[model samples]
Target: MPVCFNPLDLLMKNITPRSQIKRGENHSTRDVLLRLFLLLGIFFLLFPLRTVVAAESSGSDQQLIRMSEILRNKEKALQEKELLLREKEKRLAVLQQELQQKEKDIELLRQRAEKVLAEFQALKDEDLSRLVAVFSAMKPVAAAPLLEKLDLPYAVEVILRMQPRKAAKLLSAVNAERAAAISRSITSAKAAVE
Candidate 1:
């Protein structure tokens, strides 16, 4: 192998003194060179400490970035939950409005039905009154036979609407079995009303 010359070894070699009187000058130069090498060695040793500090700072920065990403994801999830809650509230409000409208419609229908029922009752009463008047004009013996031919409930309603004296006279004329059945129906109807 070729011999390699070392620059550091060449710099450390003793210089030739020109004369005995220059010996002290060479010793002073060697001391100065030794101090310079020590300073350069210290600088190189401290360079690795600076690199270690830089690496630790970079690691802290990476940790901060990761924490920030986590916070952002949590914030996004919270926003989504709030949006869902708002949508549910809107749907609940709409359903409540529909329920209220249905209730109003049902109430109106119930009132209309009551009005129609009242009108029908008034017409029935007028008819019953007319029938009673017709029967009152005829003899009880003749009217009783016709009344007995009617359904028991209808016969009882007609008899109950007549004058007490007329109703008693008609009842006396009707067949015993038919009159008893009519009386029973009238009694049941009165009890239900009470």
Candidate 2:
């Protein structure tokens, strides 16, 4: 393999005069080159330090002012976050309370529905006479819905208990065959519940 040398090294070697380069009182060329390299190294090493010192000298008060502003901004943001969290918590609490109240309302509605269902279940042919008795006392026009809630026998009893005029009118509105059947059975009917 062939050897290869740097171009700058070859140039330096060719420029040597008087068979040797000599040291001088003022400074040798090598010494000047060394001093230049040292100065360059010192400048490089102190570059960031010089910048910091310059910044400190020119704007230390400004730096402090900026730091305080940043701190205040962070504090405000923290306070806003805290306030938002508290508000959210309050809203959550209100929603929880509303949910609990809704649950209570639902339970009450369920209980009332059960009670109504029980009352409905308790009614049967045995209560026919009692329904008729109540319908007899109530106006026919007003008692229709109550009678309607009852079974066929009870409804017939209630209709028969009405005044002849009203009963005739209601019977006309009612199914003829069913009304006749109820009219025949009502006289012998008694209330019974399941």
Best by TM-score: 1
Instruction: Point to the candidate with the largest lDDT.
Output: 1
Candidate 1 lDDT score at position 100: 100
**lDDT for each candidate structure:** 0.84, 0.69
- TM-score for every candidate vs. truth? 0.69, 0.37
**lDDT (Cα, tens digit) per residue for candidate 2, span 36-152:** 665676678679879888888769878889999999999999999999999999999999999999999999999999998888767744465566566666665576555555677
List candidate 2 segments past 4 Å from native: 1-55, 124-194
Model 1 Cα shift for residue 14 (angstroms): 21
| Tens-digit per-residue lDDT, 1-194, candidate 1 | 99967544554455333364364454566656665775586677568868888888888988999999999999999999999999999999999999999999999999999999999999988988888888878898999889988878778888998899999999999999999999889999999999
